[model samples]
Target: MKRYRQFEPVLISGFKILEWTHPEHNHNHYEFIFIREGTGRHIVNGHSFPYKAGSIFLLGPDDQHYFEIEQLTHFVYLKFTDAYLCRNSSGSTSAIQQLEYLIKSRETHQMGFQLVGEDNAIITLIFDTLLLLRKDQIVNQELIWFQLFTVVHVLQRNMPELRSNSFKSRDLQAMFCYIHKNIYDPNRLRI
Candidate 1:
């Protein structure tokens, strides 16, 4: 019910050392949250899940969430909007659109991905590098955009495969595939 709306296109990335407190809230912008350290539970849209260091959660505008921080935590959030993604005609519109669809279609209001195993090292490295640039007030917009895009792509690629518990028939599978394939064209999807 609470919506945090920002009109301007922006990319905000930062690290926060926090107390055991997080407000329950929702936003108009998209959020990619990475837990740098500590332990807690993240509750989104009534779904509760435990979280620890390396936990990552992606949220769209429709989700409402908050955290029960059990310990002192370090949080990193990459907040952006579609306007930000399209701020420049970098020929990335289609890719961003796909990423948006992926984010929306995947698990909602829960841990989208965990920065574990090989992902731990790679994501940490990228996070650290980006944090440094941010701290220094670097003006490398292109680099920042690309790095954040990479992070989104990683999350999308790591998302769990959709489970079709309702439709077990091969016809359902074909129908689902066809729907996805024609998602971009309204006329094709209608037919």
Candidate 2:
């Protein structure tokens, strides 16, 4: 299996093709894949999930995936490095720890994000704005981070509700709820 390496901090790119040319591969950076159009099965770690226009997938560094296209597919990828995520917390070790805890959670991977309901419009707008700013080479760092964080919060909020059995311990469950409940308030989520 091939493992891809990304040298850039962030990247937003789009393409349309009738077939998936790349083999199943994992990358060093995190990825948000937006299915702009078409239909297909997205195979991730040997699991296949059907996808159509507006489907969005979040891939962590360890995830291996590829598309099995059934129709012409249009893809837009938002890739970013860990450094980009933790850039705001220059010297805060807990920031990185918290990021790794939430982002690397195995359960989160099981619930692939969607482009559904009101979130559909919000996410679409963010992507469109980011793409336009990226094209113009005039991205406002704060605005980009704000948009990305907003997307993350939306994903968190919409995650399927977990029962007591879902978590190993009561404390863990509480932490999860507290963290997600106050996601927009950084001070409240500080570890």
Candidate 3:
């Protein structure tokens, strides 16, 4: 098993798994899983989806989810706290807000999203950015922000059904507060 610790608030790691088993549980930080290759059964909030290549799973804070991977699998995961997302500029903040909306909509509606076509290239960039962020060097926050923006932009481009411009600043703040306060509660946000 491999683990990573965050000294700078966000942790990004990649894994190529021959075999993997995760205990049924949830986390306090937001999790983005980009599957480069594999097939599996993903069980999230009692809904199970067949996981395949190009599957992107976004698990918001404390969203009960786990996976059973059968056969070889390669994926990149990025985990970051809400505080980190909130620290960036308005556009970055809006992107994170959209992500939150997607997660909530996924959980509430039991919807799963798959990245296709040019979206794959954008996801690859996000993986590359994670690798760059791992190096022991003074990282340029602006560059990372740009990479993050690219990821969100691709997501927004590909998943227009999940996109919404109705989110306001107060809604973003309330969502963050709700996530922090009810992170461990499974019944907190029922569609």
Per-model TM-score versus the true fold: 0.75, 0.74, 0.70
lDDT of 1 at 80: 74
- Candidate 3 segments whose C-alpha is farther than 4 A from its true place: 1-8, 90-93, 107-111, 160-191
Task: Identify the runs in model 1 with alpha carbons over 4 angstroms from their true place.
Answer: 17-22, 136-138, 162-191
> Per-residue lDDT of 1-191 in model 2, one digit per residue for the tens?
98999987778788899989889999999987878789989988888888887787888989989989999988888888978876755664554554455577665554366658788878777777777767743356666666666667666556555333455578888988998899999998766
Q: Per-residue lDDT of 52-132 in model 1, one digit per residue for the tens?
A: 888888888888888888887787777778788767547887668657766767473465567568877777777776676
| Candidate 3 structure quality by residue, lDDT tens digits, 117-178 | 77786687677777677664246566666665576667655565434433455689889899
Query: lDDT: which candidate is best?
Result: 2
Poorest 10 consecutive residues of model 1 by lDDT? 159-168
Residue-pair clashes per candidate:
0, 0, 0
Off by over 4 Å in 2: 90-102, 136-139, 162-191
In candidate 1, which residue pairs get closer than 3 Å at backbone N, Cα or C atoms, i.e. clash? none
